[model samples]
Target: MGLLIIRLITFLNSQAPETTNYHIAMTMLANYSNLHLISIGKIAKLCNVSKSTISKFARQLGFDDYLDLKDNAAFIENRFNNPLNYLSNILTSIETDGFDNYLNAVTTDINFLRVNLDFDAVDNIAKAINDYDNVAAFGLVFSESAAIDMQYKLAYNGKFIRTFQDDVIQEDFLRNAGEDTLIIILTNSGDYLTKQQIKLGTPRKDIFSKTKAKIVVISSNPVVKNFSFVDEALIFPHQTKYQTHSIMYQIITDLIVSRYRYFNSLL
Candidate 1:
């Protein structure tokens, strides 16, 4: 899920279905394929509201203006190939290859991780979480779910961590972080470093450059190793066709937090 869509969906979920904000958000989602074509005037007319109403709706969703909202939408449009499309691909595979075959592929990925994952690097990350007073984990959509899971699991082990759902705030935190901060990027495909951009027009590389925090990128994408900004890159197994599912992130999070618990004598 792109951050823009996530915000829109969140807005829709919070508002009543008959509200103008809900109608506008539902319209934007339904016409997401042509989000660039959306304008305040058009949405206002469609929803039987004034242009000011649409602009207010945009601000309520955290955009400075309607144009800013559209710009973010365009950014998401370019960054993501639509995760739902990837889900459809998985569904097609299950239909064609059988559910048992799909499960076997998932098992193969789990087995590969169990065999190939570097326990030393896992311990190092866990140690960093213990050493640093401020730690934040970030990822997109499904990967973000893993970060939240990590936050919860670590809480039980007496390690409180932070996770951000909004990319704008996530970047703000990065830009202002101190040297004592430990930034963990939990990306399944590593697209955040290579392709993602902040709403302020800064690329991920630029944001990393501005941050003094130690950066660790845990990804299945091997290409992250080429990035100099990453202080440590824990590259996970990437041979599976189920990259869209992001199951590895949860597994890796469990491993890291479990190790953190072990180091604290709670395991």
Candidate 2:
């Protein structure tokens, strides 16, 4: 991987890709792909380029598609997963501006969610979670904790929510799922890579293939347009070195539960 990255850097220095955004995107891919899990859409948004332009940049790098580039990035990310190192990195950010910056960052993100998120779309997603015969939250590590949080919050309301961490258990949940099941998946990318090193989805296939389980994805990264088979995706802002994805996921979970209760009150 080091050799490949060195060669990639050399190529970027020499060839000078189509646009400045390409250069920025490739440089990020070369250095921090492992540390920061980002989607093409996030890079595009960060670079102020179109998604197609990002795809074009990947092709310039010899990948077959943008997803391939992202998968390669995930493969690289797999090696750098570290708990204490990550925690230290996040801590360093606190020194930059202290509690005020911390509070502002989180508040800004929540306001961004309130302004940009579609409540009707959220209502549709909440309705699915509320109306489903069975609901399962699937993820690993930090993401798994978010799933557990969702279950604990809703189970008090009499929702039969199941949360899974073990692969064996998740497979059982999926195999038995059907039109009645709603699966909430947590990950930066649907590729399901994480610091815990657990891969939940099958290679080259979306999870939940065996049944008609409705999928609601609350992603830590940018979700590209028209993600097939996914009924809903609530995207979190791209994590800076210090940011946490679960913060945004928690906000969404709160809104979903609150929305559910609000509607039930009308009944």
Candidate 3:
């Protein structure tokens, strides 16, 4: 569970608000958690109250001020597995201030990418792709588009990249995929198909465990790294509730393509 979810759950479990201010505060946090972010004015507007009302609401929630609550919420949300939610929070935060806030958010995201990226893992993925005779990419509902995007980008470089949506096609590819084959999976929720081969679904866990080909997972959840069958795992920055996964997917795909180009240049 992401920190935003946890905070929301915690707030929900709290006793019913005794005052209007407290109620407003609870609502702000609740809505913010679901939406992934909000500003004081927005919260006030949504609650049909004055900005001061929202500020009082924050203090009632044990925050020193409104900004303190927002910052804390953003920090907690960033630690979770939901990159989309985390990104939403960052975007919301950006909207609250001027250009400086936007720049800070971008810088934060870039720093996060630098800190968490595993170059060795990326190198392994590049090598697998270079050596593979065939490559297939798979993603769940939210990730399917991203998978296709990656396929198109990789194909432009004269590589055979197949994108799979169903289990029948995936299994067919997996069965045919050898030691020199690579399977790239994209999932932010960390859940993928894992059922009968004919069903167009295969449990992500099973795919990792059973496939003989090299596997690379671009996931929001850290559990992807726990699978021994996975050859490499790349974790994108977590997003807040209001944000979408499209930006993160674009960033990850671009990084992979850049790496591929650099590796090819050396060859």
Best by lDDT: 1
After TM-score superposition, the amount by which residue 122's alpha carbon in candidate 3 deviates from its true location, in angstroms, is 2.6
Model 2, 1-267: lDDT tens digits are 222243245346555478675466575654554413677777777667788987776676555766765565543332444432334445666776686776777777777777887677668767887777678887755677788898988877767688854544566676678877888887755555222233213345344455578877777565522566677877766424445666877878888888877765665
lDDT of 3: 0.64
Cα deviation of 46, candidate 1, in Å: 6.0
Clashes of each: 0, 0, 20
Alpha-carbon runs more than 4 Å astray in model 2: 1-85, 95-102, 193-206, 222-225, 239-241
lDDT of 1 by residue, 1-267 (tens): 354688886566557998767888888888776686777888677778899988888887778898888876753433444443344557776888788877788888888888999888899898888888899998766777788888998998888999877666677898999999999998766667765633444345578767899999898778887878888778786555655346777788888888887777743
Q: Mind giving the per-residue lDDT tens digits that candidate 3 earns over 133-227?
A: 77888875447678888888888877768876543355567766778778898876566533322121222335556668888888777787877
How does each model score on lDDT?
0.77, 0.64, 0.64
| Regions of candidate 3 where Cα sits further than 4 Å from its true position | 1-111, 193-207, 242-244
Name the lDDT of candidate 1.
0.77
- Give the TM-score (vs. native) of candidate 1: 0.79
- Cα RMSDs of all predictions? 4.0, 16.3, 15.8
Specify the poorest-scoring 10-residue window by lDDT in model 3.
195-204
